[model samples]
Target: MKKIRAALLGATGAVGQRYINMLDRHPFITLEVLMGGESAGKKYGQAVHWLFPDAIPERFAEAQVRTARPESAEGCDVVFSALPSEVASEIEQDFAKAGFTLVSEASSHRMDPDVPLMIPEINPGHLELLEAQKKARGWKGAIATTPNCTVTGLAIVMTPLLDNFAAEKAIVTTMQALSGAGYPGVPSLAITENVIPYIKNEEEKVAKEAKKILGAVKGGAIVPHELPIGISCNRVPVIDGHTETLYAEFPKAVKPDQVARVLERFSGLPQKLRLPTAPERPIIVRRENDRPQPRLDRMSGSVPGMSVVVGRVRNGIDERSLQLTLLSHNTIRGAAGTAILTAELMQKEGYIG
Candidate 1:
């Protein structure tokens, strides 16, 4: 099989660095172009702050960073965007208009009626919306987005429960990591010893995006699931993982054991198709009371940082309610990693060649 040529936009940010690490020796995609804002003319190594503990990949060390314009991505088949939402909105569309499949981490297009805000394991069917998106926008290529870092874990955990027990309402409270705020994020003075109770628009994104991700595709549009999701987001002192506590109400009575069994047995399109980046198990159920901690379980799957760690499953406020805690690597499973998985899914579904 010929490798798909890909480009990375915002190549100097935290999420962009992860994209670089992930694509270093990717099985199906090759990193051919590196684009950034102010770092456009410098070598990638010189421009990037290099956040990861691992050294920069030699392949991209000397690569010249180009400006984040569609024309700079001329030879790419796919464009993986880590660009900020403010700038990504226009630039991503430009790439799609130029006929490049775009998998974006920015929030710009996640809720667009035609765009598919995807978690491959939970909503592969939603990819069909890409067709409607292209036709509506008159673009040759289409845009697909991964949800906010906080929503990714919540949606993935809720998927199996929703399927097995018809969960209709959810209340999620998140203790998100500092990384989710991006590089040089949250001032040291504010988040050093305290928990900032608010993140601009994060609560809204989780509430709306989850329903859309869990929604059905019909008549060329996505009808968001009728389920009610309420969320409370907070920025914590942790460095890498986002931890969420979820309370869900099911239509019928459910036992904690039953919920665990369903989650343990759950697998979706990505798992069935054996996509290269798919985790062997999308959710890992832990029985210990204090499990799923950010430091211990954030990277808990066969594919590290690809699985959501779920623990402390128990009865909620009533017999019809179920509650559990989940942890996921925000930058990996939530942003860059999920974007890569979406691209792999697009390739498998023949949306990208």
Candidate 2:
């Protein structure tokens, strides 16, 4: 595989910084251009409110942040947009219209009819939509998006359940981390020692994005899975990882051991292709009753923070139902890591150079 040059759209923000951290020594992709809004003219290190404990890699720290525009990304093989949703809508479109292929972590285009809302493991074939996306949108480039942070782990867990045990409906309750809100997120007065019961739009985004991601690509578009989903989202005091408790109904009786076996063995295209960012095991099932805690299990994987960890697999009220708890790193698996995996998949599948 040839080395690819990549540009980032929101280089000074939280998710953008995660891209820098993860891409610092990427096998093929190189972060050549850094773009930002108010921080556009300053060097990345100087402008960012750098969140991670580790220092920002020196190269990216010194890289000057460019204004978010298509020309700012000239010569780059791909553009990764980590911009906020409201602003990402316009700027990302401008880049696509200008011929820059984009892999974004923004919510603006996730539900678009032609655009792919991807979880590479769950729907690699969805990338096929990019071709029609380019044609229908009348642009040389196309956008491929990732699911909402809250949806990533839940959807990953649901995939095997639905396929193996024929799970018919899901009831989910999430205790999300503060980092999911981005830097300086959830004010001290608002979130300290508090569990905010609501995060506007999170529940809906989770259900819709999960369905689309788990959907099958048909007729040059995706036919979303029609699984019934009931979700209750809440913001917790944790700093990373979103934890969700899921209760699912299946068509027939299924055993906890069977569900554990299926989930623990799940893997997809990225794994088969041996993509650099692909986790050795996308799902890790724990047996202990008090397992999959956010602090301990969020980063549990060969590829750290990339796997969804499940525990407490058991029966629900009836023999035809199942229950489990899941945890995933909100900023990593949920944001930057998945986007990078999508980029790697794109490169492998010849969607990008």
Candidate 3:
């Protein structure tokens, strides 16, 4: 099988760097193009300021970075877009029309029925709608996106319960890392020792994206569920992982141990597919009381690519709900890792050549 040649738009930014590191050894993809906005024209090594401890891989050192525009991405079989939402909406649509499969991390096209915004482990079934999307838009390729980082982590924790029982509503509070905003994101004065109670559009993204990800695909389109997620999104001074506290009310009465068991042992459709980037466990239920801390365990092997670590499971306010704390590598499992899994699903399903 010929290797799938791919491009990374927004390749000079934080999320793009994660895509680079994840794709460094990807069995199915070749990093054929690296495109950025202001950072265009530099080599990948120079364009990117390495933050994560992992060194930049040799394959990407000399790769030239170009303008992250559609015309510059010629010859790629798929384009994993880590571009900002506004920029991504434009470039991704053009690339899809140009006949390249677009697995995007941007939220622009996420709500479109034609575009499948996915967390492969939680909702691989949604990708089925991509066929109708392509035909409707008269495009050669389709777009599949990962939900927002907070949504990705939150949804993974909810899936097993949603599958076994039914999720009535959820009240969540997220302490999102500054990195979610991008490189040089929050200024020192703003976040040095502060916790801003509100993030501009994050709460909306978390609420809306969760429903789309948990939605079902029917008649070649997704019908989003009417589940309500009351959310509060905050920007913390933390550098890497985003942590979320959730109170999920289930229709059935399930214990904390039951939730732990479900999260600990559950592996979804993506794991079964054996997608190269799919983690063996999508959600790791940590037993240690203080586990899943950003500095100590956020980058742990549980997320070799696709896992989300969830710990501190306990009873919620009432008998009908359960409380848990979850953590995910903002750029890895939340951004690039999910994008890679989306591409793997597209490849196995023959969306890409």
Candidate 4:
């Protein structure tokens, strides 16, 4: 099988760096173009500030960065976008109109009714929306997005619970990592000693996007989950993982052991197809009381950073409520890795072949 030629848009930010790392040795996709804004005319190595622990790959180090224009990406089979939401809305559509499939990490299109806000294991069915999107927009290609990073962990954990126990309401409080803010993020003086309790528009994104991700696709449209979700987002000093505490009210009583059993055995389309980036266990249940901490569990999974580590599953204040803490690598499973996995599913389903 020939490798698909791909382009990386917004190739000089935190999320963009993750895309570069994951695509460096990807089995099915080749990084053929690098695009950026101010960094457009420089070599990738010179343009990027280089935040990741791993050294930038030599193959891409000397590749010239180009402006993110459709013509610059003409021959690529797919475009992996990490552009800011404000800029991505227009540029991603331009690429789609110019006949390129876009697997994006931008928040701009996550709520669009026609675009698929996908979690391969949780909502592979939503990809069907792409057909409607292409038809409605009159484009040869389409956009598929992963939800906001904060929403990713929340939605993944909620999926199994909703399937086996059925949720009536959910409340998630998050301690998101500093890297989520992007490069030159929150001044050290502000974040080093204290936790900032708000992220502009984060809480709303988590609440709304979760419903869409866990929603059902019907009659050429997605029917969002009716379950009510409330969220509070905070920015912590940690560098990589996002930790969330979930409290849910299920319709009926469910024991901790039952919830653990369902989460431990959960697997979806990515696992069945054995996509390279998919973790063997999407959710790793920890029996210890002090587990799932960002320092220790952020890298949990066979594919490191691909799994969500869950702990402290117990009854809440009442028999109908359950509480637990979950941790996920914000940049990997929450952003770039999920986008890559979505593209893999597209290939398997004949949407991108």
Q: Who wins the TM-score comparison?
A: 2
> Which residue pairs collide in model 1, if any?
none
RMSD of 2: 0.8
Give per-residue CA lDDT, model 3, range 1-353, as digits (tens).
Answer: 45788888888888988888788878878888999888799888887888778788876878788887777878888898988997778778888887878888888898887778888777877888778888999988778888888888888887787887687888999999999999889888999889999988888888888888888888887888688889998899898899888888888787888879888888877788777888888888888888778777676664463668888988788777888888988888889988888888778877786
In candidate 1, what residue range of length 10 has the lowest lDDT sum? 1-10
Measured over all alpha carbons after superposition, the RMSD of each candidate to the real structure, in angstroms, is 0.9, 0.8, 1.6, 1.0
Clashes of each: 0, 0, 0, 0
Alpha carbon deviation, residue 161, candidate 3 (Å): 1.4
Error of 4 at 290 (Å): 0.7
Give the per-residue lDDT digits (tens) of candidate 2, residues 1-353: 89999999988888998899899999999999999999989988899998889998998888899999899999999999999998999999999999889999999999998999988998988999999999988998999998899999998999999888888999999999999998888998999888999999998899998899888888888888999999999999999999999999988999999889999999999999999999999999999999999999988888899999999999999899998999999889999999999999999999998
Backbone clash pairs for candidate 3 read none
Better of 1 and 2 by TM-score: 2
Residues 209-310, model 4: lDDT tens digits? 989888898877788998898888999999999999999998888899889889989999999999989999999999999989999999988988999999
Give the Å shift of residue 310 in candidate 3. 1.4
What overall lDDT, based on C-alpha atoms, would model 2 receive against the true structure? 0.93
Report the Cα lDDT for candidate 3: 0.83
**Best-matching candidate per lDDT:** 2
Least accurate 10 contiguous residues by lDDT in model 4: 1-10
TM-score, candidate 3, is: 0.95
Q: Rate the local accuracy (lDDT) of all candidates.
A: 0.91, 0.93, 0.83, 0.91
